[model samples]
Target: MLPKEAYDAGHYVGVVAHSTANNGDSADGERNYESTTWQNAFVHFFVDDQKIEQVANTDYICYGAGHTANHLGYVQVELCQTTDAAKFTKAYAMYTWLLAKLLFNRKLSVVDGVTLMSHAQVSAKWKESDHTDPIEYLASHGKTWANLVADVSANYKEMEGTDLKLQTLILYSGDADLQVAADLAQHFCCPIVQVAFATSDLLLSATTKYQVGGASAPAGVTLLSGADRYATMHAVLTLLGK
Candidate 1:
């Protein structure tokens, strides 16, 4: 079951794998009694190689976690298996596919060094009770949960920077009626007026103006602000093809 917030926020995806045995059969078995029993049943969505099963409503709270049962913004995806290498391959594939779908549908980019924690992250009780599932399974595959999260966060940051650049260009072109010149001046730590005038000879004069011990004029340009404002503006316009 995909959480509404996962769909709404368009970013986060949660994956869970069971550590304990599902029913009487081994982790590789297709059917388990634990999956059938109402009292012992836990988790919302269960994934097997052959099919996906939904046990609880994504919108409602499920009794998957012993302590933290009511996490407001989490999607619980459970793998129907125990800690077995054979079952882990299928589980890995399922989790990877789910993650891909979540990222694609939500337009999320993963960041490097971000932490993808587990149920243990939220609940101390679960952690203290020796309850470990996906974390162990993931470690066996030589992938830490933190690394997975970092991958997502790194991509997310890259995409965000790209979006900001596009927005800056649109504003600078005056298409959005934004004060991009002022914004650029503030970002570059220079005077707006000086930045405006230096736009004409930015490539050539900027280096000299910003050079150490250079005669700094308004906006750090070498040229004086008086009388030369018009000439500077004209040069800038010509260079910009305005």
Candidate 2:
């Protein structure tokens, strides 16, 4: 159902397949993805060693949260399998990356608490059902909520400037988004500074929508906006003159 509409809930939750095959085969996971799609037991994404597939529309809702309201309110993601340590590590990274991507697409910061959630967290608060997920699986690996959120934050920073180089600095008018600064430096192969004021290019949402706080751009830089992260990143590159 979420595939057909928008997720007004503006929240996302994570889950793990309670039962999966011992053989972590891509074909096997693909079959599961297809089955879930047809069975109408849909979730937004499925992550395995083979791929991270989006089965439903994130703008809409999907089931598997174990309750009616949440079933339709949150974007549900299922990690394919992790019966052992090696598999867990890979699946964990993929899950973290996917979560960061989703958060970025939604214009939410990794530090923002409103959108990210655990299935167990939903159950505990809403009494929608009495099941905890991925938690039990994560606990066995010595991972916790703090660890997961940190991973997302880390991944989100990387996304802000993947494959980017380090000549350009970021400028802004209103607030600033510095999460991408370290990443920009990594890609630019050096450090980039934040300055003030630029043009308006990316306005998918509000002009200053994705800007971060506390950090200020230089006193008089152009407040340019990228159409999406790609444009913003390139604009930064162009400004860097790299």
lDDT by residue (tens digit), candidate 2, 122-205: 677678667676667677778877788789889888877552423344333232346454554455454334333433322211
User: Which lDDT value does model 1 have at 81?
Assistant: 52
Q: Which stretches of candidate 2 lie over 4 Å from their true place?
A: 1-3, 9-40, 66-72, 111-113, 161-242
- For model 2, what is the alpha-carbon lDDT of residue 179? 48
lDDT of every predicted structure (CA atoms):
0.43, 0.56
TM-score of each: 0.42, 0.56
Top TM-score prediction, candidate number:
2
State how far residue 139 of model 2 sits from its true place (Å).
Answer: 1.5
* CA shift of 24, model 1, Å: 10
Error of 1 at 5 (Å): 16
Rate residue 107 of model 1 by lDDT: 57
Q: Which candidate leads the pack in lDDT?
A: 2
